[model samples]
Target: MKFLKSGLEALDEVTVIALGSNMAGGYPSSEALLEAALARFPGARLPVLARSGWWRSAAWPDPGEPEYRNGVALVETSLRPRAVLEALFSIERGFGRTRGAANAPRTLDLDLIACGREVIDAPGLVLPHPRAHERLFVMGPLAEIAPGWVHPTLGRSAAELVVTATVGADAIPI
Candidate 1:
């Protein structure tokens, strides 16, 4: 961790993380699994500052599967973007999330939506998640928690993006 002249970590970044789940696995319900996953953020060094209530939406590409429970989290942390991504992946794994088919039902899905104002496009990481701004499941909850959060690249607030989100339009707070 790099300390600034004022004693703040260079990585004192308040970030947005999007959470989603459709399969409960062993938990009683997907919503319960989501709550459990949020509880782990603090242990991962990403303490949750605020979070939106869980929203529900039919599974995309195949509504025949299961409905998804999604929400957004605002966390205060000292971890850089890459480390934040790693922590999210680790949390997902600890919840029995398996990497298999695309769009498959998942026990937990944690996405690093934005890391402050930094813009990064790496092989396995992308700041402000590439398509997050286009998904209502991601944006609606975000607008609920942080309406003024601006997309690093697009320069649009979460409230603005929610109106035009093309995907996940069926999402509604549950």
Candidate 2:
């Protein structure tokens, strides 16, 4: 058995998937995003953490709406980063995520290229979340699962970033 050897060598990188769902209505949330991902990727080993409290962040130029309920997940998969990203986007679209806003409250969002063992700043993706070190909501939940996973560029771990980033000071654990 022979393998195709191109300029790009066989990349053996682990996948770190992040899942986030949006809240619908004012009371009974109509969005069901995370549950759907779980159904699709069963036996996923990453810890699924969530935060229910919505924070009033700068809206992403969409229709001004309610704050967003966000969370993060750390998954381990063999699929390449791009492949995983596509899968996540498909999941987001399934939950009604439109590219209408830069920071709008969404029904569901699955940011697949959050972090990895190495730093990757590509055209469409930036590893370690690029802003992971700045967002508490992401750091908090990511810390729960990948405390030891270090940031390729920052020389820090998820736990460190979460504590350093105070944005999630009022995150409601769910």
Candidate 3:
């Protein structure tokens, strides 16, 4: 592993994180909330290297819900896999996300899409995001920043995955 200037073993791992928001609840607009949430990454020890423009898409499983603003960010961090996951959760909570139903609309959503070439299948965290390849919202924004990024588990590039995404046809660049 690489070491940072502070002598800490830098996680040195590049991670792709998917950002989404629908209902703002008490926050600003969904897109604004997403942007603000991303802004916190750098302060949380996750420095963003690149990010995609916002994309709009209908909420999954429940199209009746408000459309979601989606984007993807490439970040570098020195934290462990689980620590990274926890950080994401913390960010979500900071934005007023609540744990209720699966795929439910919320103020913010952060998904850890991938981390370097690591493949993790732990209980609470899964690397390369289990459903990333199938979600157009995720793949479209991910392709914008890292088209050549390969999914460790699927062995396919983000661009390729976007071409075959079955559910994201409604995703449009905003």
Q: Which candidate has the top score in lDDT? A: 1
Query: What value does the lDDT take at residue 139 in candidate 2?
Result: 64
Error of 1 at 98 (Å): 1.1
User: Which residue segments of model 2 deviate by more than 4 Å?
Assistant: 1-14, 25-32, 42-64, 113-115
Query: Pairs clashing in candidate 1?
Result: none
Q: Is candidate 2 or candidate 3 better by lDDT?
A: 3
Candidate 2 versus truth, CA RMSD in Å, comes to: 8.9
Tell me the tens digit of each residue's lDDT in model 3 across 67-90.
Answer: 999988878888887888889999
Candidate 3 lDDT score at position 50: 79
**Residue 134 in candidate 2, Cα distance off native in Å:** 0.8
Model 2 residue pairs with clashes: 60-103
Tens-place lDDT per residue, model 1, 1-174, is 111122223223568899999999889999999999998999999988778899999999899989999999888788999999999999999999888999999999999988988888889998879999999999999888677777888988889999999898999998
**lDDT, candidate 2, 22-108, per-residue tens:** 545232552344555545553333333222222223223333555445545445565666666776777666656787756656677
User: What C-alpha lDDT, on a 0 to 100 scale, does residue 11 get in candidate 3?
Assistant: 21
Better of 1 and 2 by TM-score: 1
On a 0 to 1 TM-score scale, where does candidate 1 land against the true structure?
0.92
Error (Å) of candidate 1 at residue 82 is 0.9
lDDT of 2 at 9: 17
